[model samples]
Each structure stands twice: as C-alpha cells, then as structure tokens.
Target: MLTPSLMHHLSIIPDFRQAWKIKHQLSDILFLTVRAVICGAEGWEEIEDFGHEKLGFLRQYGDFESGVPSHDTLARVMALINAKQLQTAFADWMKACHDATDGAIVAIDGKTLRGSYCRGKDKAAIHMVSAFSTANGVVMGQIKTDEKSNEITAIPELLKLLDLYGCLVTIDAMGCQKKIAHQIRRQGADYLLSVKDNQPKLADAFEAAFPMKVIANYAGDAYTTVEKNRGREESRYHVVSDVSHEFQGLICEWPDLKTVGAVVSFRQEGDEPPDEAVVRYYISFAELTAEQMAKAVRQHWHVENKLHWFLDVAMREDACRIRRGRAAENLGRVHHIALNYLKGETRFKGGIRRKQKKAALSEEYLADVLAV
Candidate 1:
C-alpha cells in the first residue's frame, strides 16, 4: 500500500504555478512524471501519453479530478518548478525509504546531460553531482551546475543536503579538493579522495611514499585480486599504510588525515600486448586495511556503473532534450526517483532494463514497484 507520508512528502515541494490559474496539483504532476519515467516514458509527450493511459492507476495514488494534463502543461510546470526544492524533497523521500547505516560508503560523482545543451541558444549542457549510497543502491542527493568544472563548488553544496554522519565518502580526482575533504570531515563522515596531477605536490608525495622498490619488498598490508572474462584478464593490487610519520608535510595540509593508499591495476586483452599498468593513489580520513581500501575504491564506481550508466543506457538520460529553464534539472531528479524505486524492487529477478519493460507491459508490476 502506498503510505500517506509518501504522498505528503511529494506535496511539500513548493509549487511555482500561479494559484489562480493552477489546474493540476503539483504532487499529481510530479507523481505522474515519476511513474511514467519508470515505465519508459522519455519526453513530455510520452509522459502525457502514459498519464492518459494510466490515469486509473495514477488515480489510486493522487487525485486527478481534471484528468491528466497536456504535454505542454507538464513541460511548463516542470520548467518553472524550483529544481533545488524538488531535489531536497527527493532526497528526504529517499532517506525515509532507507535508513543509511554507519560506515556505509557514499560515492559522489558528476555526469553531464549531453542532450540538454542547445547550440541555437548558446545554452550549455547541464552537469549534476550526485551522492549515491553504495550499500543501499539509491541516490541520496544531487545538485546541478552549469558545467563539469563547477562540480568542485557544487559538491560541497550537495554534501550539505545529505545525512552523512559516520559514513565514508569517496570521490574521483576532480572532487579531490582540500575544501571538499574538509567539508566531508566536518559532516562527521570520513573521506577517500583519489589523487592525481590536479594536486601535483600531493600526488608526488603519495608516489614518493609508495615507491616501486618499497612496494616490492616492504609490504605491510597488501591485497590483490584478479578476474578473467571474455578472454580478458585484469589484476588489481592494493597497498595501504599509516603515513602520518613519513608524509607529515603532506598530511598537515589535509584535515583529519589518517591513511595513504595505492592501487596498481594491470590488464591484458585477447590477442593484444599487455596494457601499460596504471597506478592510482588515495588519501583517506579513515583507518582502513588494504582489503577494506580495495573494496571501498572498487565500490566507488557504483555511481558510474550503476547510477550514471543506468541513467544513460536504460533511461536514455543523455538523449533527453528538456533544456528549457529548470525542466532538465527537474526531470533528472524524477529519473533518480524512478531509478531508486526500480532498484528497491527486488521481487523481480532481472536487470533494470528488463524491469522497466515489465512495468511498461503490465500495470500490476508497476504498482508492485511503486509500493516499495
């Protein structure tokens, strides 16, 4: 059964439509859009079509006294709605659905909606930074920026909206800023940030601390894993250490710094020479063993593989062209909401694409997904 609190959560999003001219309720339109997107609707027209076809199903959750609105109405309302307000409500709804556990890994990353850009109007594509709960497989929160370069500033804002106490946060090299690290620490959560030439001095220090000669003989705590599939073989080597004593100069610049780690990856494909090995370094505020570090680092890609990949491949996020005002940003939030719903629905034994097809074909299964 759909709970009243769920409807109440959706109702709290501030409606920007004029009160005297309002025809459809804000929650009704939002609820319809979320359900439509979950069932494979890609644009305003498809969403309106879904609403017309599933008006009875939607009426079960929200009042549609005037019936489903037109496609233009849906687009206009979405374009005018406050994206930040909708995002906060979406995050709150996610939190209500799943309570994050302490020590859970929260991966933060950014992706651009390539199709949102408009060359005719000189509008840039929309870039969004999202916080995904690795353990829960749900997006905790997201913030939009004008471009990829703005993620450094937008990440801290995204972090402030989430409940991060006791969680371990991980970000890629682009988010490996001192201010971001401090922000994560201040939120009562630990951080594991990838190191690259973005911070040349820090990267040099980490590389110097884990020299190849030292890695060859002085192994304190090490973990290695190998995998083979489709005639391709890859191996990852992770070594972690307490570097406060040796890298004191570098440690002083970071907040709550505890450990330094390195991951070396080697790969070979079918009928090809072995690829050059790649080495990545990370600094963490948590005291983790090599095994834990390896697991956390590997799990961080869940944002890309699970969230971003699913958005682009299954949901066709990069193909969307909703570039007017805040429509694109708001639609991205709707996608996240639908994605979380589908992810939490584990009764069906298939991937997201299969489940989305099932929802489109059967309203009964769609109800089952929304019930969660």
Candidate 2:
C-alpha cells in the first residue's frame, strides 16, 4: 500500500541527524499528513483528529508521535519545514514516478491562496506562487510573497528552486515579463507565453506585424481542427514556418527570443457565430515546427484542465477558509501532495476524488499510487 513507509523509502528527505529528535519521526509526520489529507482533513484540527483516531494504523507506519501533536504544533512544524527541502523531496518523488517520460511539458504557473488573508479585515490576502509540472501533474516548487509584493516578484525565486532543463515551460500573461523570459532561457528551457493587453505595445505590434500574406500562400504543413460540444465550439489552425523575422521586435526587446508567432483560438456559441473571430496571441522561445507547436500547444492545458480544475472541483480547495498561522500555506502543500498521488494512479480512469475515496477504502489503490 501507499503507506508512510513508502514515502520514507522513496522520498528525498534530508538525512540530518536532528530530524530523529523531533517529537515525531519524519515518516510518521508524512504518513499522518498524507492519511489525514486522504481522509478529507482540511486544516490542522482535522489532521490532528484524523491522526489521533487512526493511531493504531499510524503506529504500523512508525513510532507514534508521543501524543498526536496539537493542531498548533503541526502548524508550527509545517511552517518551520524548509520549503526548499520539501520542494527537492517532492521533485525526487516525481522523478521516480515519471521515469523515461521525455519531451514532457512542465508548465509553471502561480496560484493565490485565497484563504490566506491573515491580518484581519483590512489586510491584503496572502498570495503564494507555485511552479507546477504539468507533465507529471505535480507541483515542483512554491514560494510565498513577501509583504508588499506580488507573483511577479516571487516567480523567479520559485523557478530558481526547480531544474527546468529539457522541459517546455508555459505561463500566462502574468509571466509575460522580459526578465522572467530571460530567467527561463538562462535555465536552458523553452517558453510559450500568452501575450495580452498587459504589454499593449508588444501585443499590438505582433498582431499588426504577423506574416498573414506570406503564411496563407506558403503552407508547408498545416493542421486544422474544430471541436464542437455543448453550446460552444473552438476552431484552431496551427501554421508553423520560419518565424524568426516575425520575432525581431520581441528579440530587440527581450534578447532570449528565438522564434515567435500568433496562436488564434476562435470560439463561438449559441445560435449565432460572432462576426469577428476571437483571437488569442502567443509568443514562443522554442524552434517553430508544425508538429512541435501542436504538441506543446495542446499539452499546455494540462496546467488548467488537470491541476487547477482538480483543485477546484475534486479537492474543493476554493471552498476552504482556513487562514490561521501557517495553516493556509501548509494545507495547500498537503493538497498538492495528495493531488500528485491521485494523478500518478494508473488504474483509474474516473474522477480523482472518487479514486481518492476508493484508495482510502482499498489498499491496492493506495499501493499502485505509492508504488515505485
């Protein structure tokens, strides 16, 4: 089964000697935390209750915490746990789960912990930025914002904690900054960023300057498809050729630019199709090829469809309101860990939450998920 011992056996937790002196061993802590999450524990009190109620099973994983640590103790330890260490350990676990999966697209995006607003009624909500590996469907690293800061300030720090070599990193308009582009290039990875009104001049320039005339005539290998469902429809056309000249403006502005182009997603719904095509623009740092473009473009939604959607629907994270003394940040990590476990399951094809409940009731489900 995916027991605490499995995490102990496979995790990249540090071997510091003082770890043994803690009130609870590392394995027990991880086990209880994982189990508590699996059993629907939302905050510190829920985790404590789950651990206390399952003391016997927890003992099977390792020696018991002298008494289930109080909710505050759990929160204190979680806050004190080095985020970098936990990030490294999470990365190692993902490596074991994602062996031999090359050309995997690892999308990095920031999520705000909506419930983390702590300084009473007047204070701004605490925001945390995270880099999620859309390939393995796991969160690679996360960093919280300092006072008087935003995600733009924290994204670089989070990126530094991850090894992005050989991965295609995708980010939205919030990450369209030139400095962030340079950082991604410096790390030896490619990028596909959505360009929007935030960079008005750049967006206007690209939209006005694309090779519409030449592109229509010189079709080397074009791919087009239309998906119609429910009350909406999406039509996508990918035209890939030499985009180097097209990227000259961006290159002058951001030196990391190798190639760039526009990606247009036209959507229509109800009875009437819109007169003007709704187009979204994109810029890429990767080599332009028809096949490569299609693969990367389609896979980019794994960030939204797989990670964000799961968090909102399956984990019900949006309903959470646990904003007290590290509970918010720590619980978010716990949810990330649980989501990773669920995503790694090979046997289930249904919803993640249902699979989680099945895993809770069935040891085999847990075993397959935790198995290396």
Candidate 3:
C-alpha cells in the first residue's frame, strides 16, 4: 500500500497557480502525471488519455473530484512548477524508499536532451547531471545545466543535495577537477575520477607512473575479466599501484589523493585485425585493491547502461520535444520517478519495455507499480 507520507511528498510541492483561478488540485495533477508516465505515457496528450482511461485506478490514492484535467492544463501546470522543488522532493522520496549503504558505488554522469532544442526560439538543448546508485539501480538525484561544459560546476551542486557519506563516487574525466574532488571529500565520501588530457600534467604524470613496460611485468595488484558479446570478444585488464611516492609533487595538487589505477582494454571482433588496445587512467582517494577498483570502474557504466540508456531507448527521452518553460525539465523528473518505480518492481521479471507494455495493457499491473 502507498503510505500517506509517500503521497505527502507530492502534496508538498508548492503550487504556482493562483488560488482563485485553480480548478484542479496540484497534488492530483502531479499524481496523475506520474502514474500515467509509469504506464508508458509520453506527452501531455498521452497522459490525459491515460488519466481518462485509468481514472478509477488513480482515485484509489487521492481525490479526483474534478476528474482528470485537460492536456493543456497538465502541460501548463507542469511548466509552471519549480524544477528545484521537484528535484528536492524526488531525492527525498528516493532516500525514503532505498537506504543507501556505506561504501556503495554512486556513479555521477550527465546526458543531453537532444529534442529539447528549439530552432526558431533559439533554445539550447538541456543537459542534466544525475547521480545514480549502482547498488540500488536508482537515481539518487539530478540537476540541469544549459550546457554540458557546466557539469563541472553543476556536479558539486548536485553532490551537495545528496547524502553521500561513505559512498564511493565515480565520475568521468570531465569531472576530474580539484574543486570537485575537494567537494566529494568534504561530503565525507571518497572519489574515483577518470584521468585524460583534460588535465594534461596530471595525465602525463599518471602515464609516466604506469608505463606499458611496467604493466607488462608488474604483479603487485591486478584484475582481469573477459567478456564475449555479439561476435566480439573483449578483455579488460586493470592494475593499481601506490604512486604517492613516485608522483609526490603531482599528488599535492589533488585533494585526498591515495592511489593511481589503469584500465587496458583489448577487443577482437569477427576475426578482423585485432583492434588497437585502449588504456585509461584514474585517481582515487580510497585505498582499494585492484579488484575493488576494477569493480568500481566497471560498475560506473551502470549510470550509462541502466539509467541513461533506458531513458533514451525505452522511454524515448531523446525524442521528446517539450521545451516550454520547465516542461522539459519537469517531464524528465517524472520519467525518473517512473523508471525508479519500474526498477523496484522485482516480480515483473521482464525488461523495461515489456513491463511498460504490460502496465498499459493491465490496470492491475499498473496499480502494483504505483503501490510502491
């Protein structure tokens, strides 16, 4: 059963519509939109259609005395709602549902809403930075930026909103900055940041510390895994070493730097000339074994595979064109809520697309999804 407290989160969202002109309850509209989205509703029209068909199921949670609002009403109200309030409520709700564990992997990454750009209006595509808990497979929180390059600043703000104590935060090379590393440590969490040309000196030092010759013979700490997929075989080789002494000068520039690690990948596809190998380096504050570092680095892709990929492929996020006011941003939040609910439902035993189809075909299954 959905508790009153869980429902209260939506109720507390400050309604922007004036009291005298209000025809429908704010909570009712939000509740309807979220439930409809969970059952595969994409836009305002589809959401309105879902509400009309599933009005009976919706009323089980809240009063629908005025009935489902029109698509225009849904769109207008959603556009007016504050995105920050919605994000705060979403983070709070996720925390209530999933108790984050110490030392859990939290992958931080960003995705661009390609369809949000408007040519005539000269609007830019929206970029959102999201924090995903790999352990729970749910988005902890997200924040939006006008440009992808702003993620360096937006990441610290998003981190400030999350309760990340004791979590191992992993970010891509773009996020590897001194301030971001300091912010993560200040939050009482350790960080694993990828290294690339973005930080030229640091990258050069990392390369110097772990030369290919050193990796060929060094046997201090290492982990290797082989994977086969779609007529291709790939092997990943991970190695870690205590480079504090070797790169003492460079370590001083970073925050809480402890160890440097490298990941080398080799792929052979369809008997074609073996593809050239690729190697990447990373820095971490945690004193982890090569296996642990390898696992953390491997698991970081959960944000890409589980959350971003699902949003683009399963939910058609990249195709959405709602760019009015906060409509695009708010709708993105609704999608996250729906994704989290679907992910939490273990009994479905099917992929996300199949579950969405089932929810649309069966009201009982839809109710089961909302019951959480």
Task: Report residue 166 deviation for candidate 1 (angstroms).
Answer: 1.3
Model 1, span 1-372: residue lDDT tens: 243555667777787767999889988898889889999999999999999999998898889999999999999999998887888877777667777788999999998989998999988988899999999688999989745458889998899888899999999999999999988988999999999999998888877788877776655999999989999998898999887455788766899788898888989998788799888999999999999999999999989889999999999999998988899999999899889889989989999989998999899999899887
In order of TM-score, best first, we have 3, 1, 2
TM values, all candidates? 0.96, 0.83, 0.96
- In candidate 3, how many Å is residue 112 off? 0.6
- TM-score, cand. 1 vs. native: 0.96
Candidate 3 error regions (>4 Å):
1-3, 147-149
Cα distance off (Å), candidate 1, residue 77: 0.7
Per-residue lDDT of candidate 2, residues 1-372 (tens digit): 244434743355553437556676655666678767765676678789877776776675567859677787677666565555665566555444443244557776666666566566554565666667665667765677876877787878877867778677887788888888889889877888878899886677666655566444645656566778998887776665445454555566764565555555677887786445545566777775755676677777777788878877787777777665555666676788787777767577867888777866665565566552
The total number of steric clashes, by the backbone 3 Å criterion, in model 2 comes to 0
Q: Write the per-residue lDDT of candidate 3 for residues 14-100, one digit (tens) a residue.
A: 878789988889988988888888778889999999999988877888788989999999989999899999988888777677777
Clashes per prediction? 0, 0, 0
- What are the Cα lDDT values of the candidates? 0.88, 0.68, 0.88
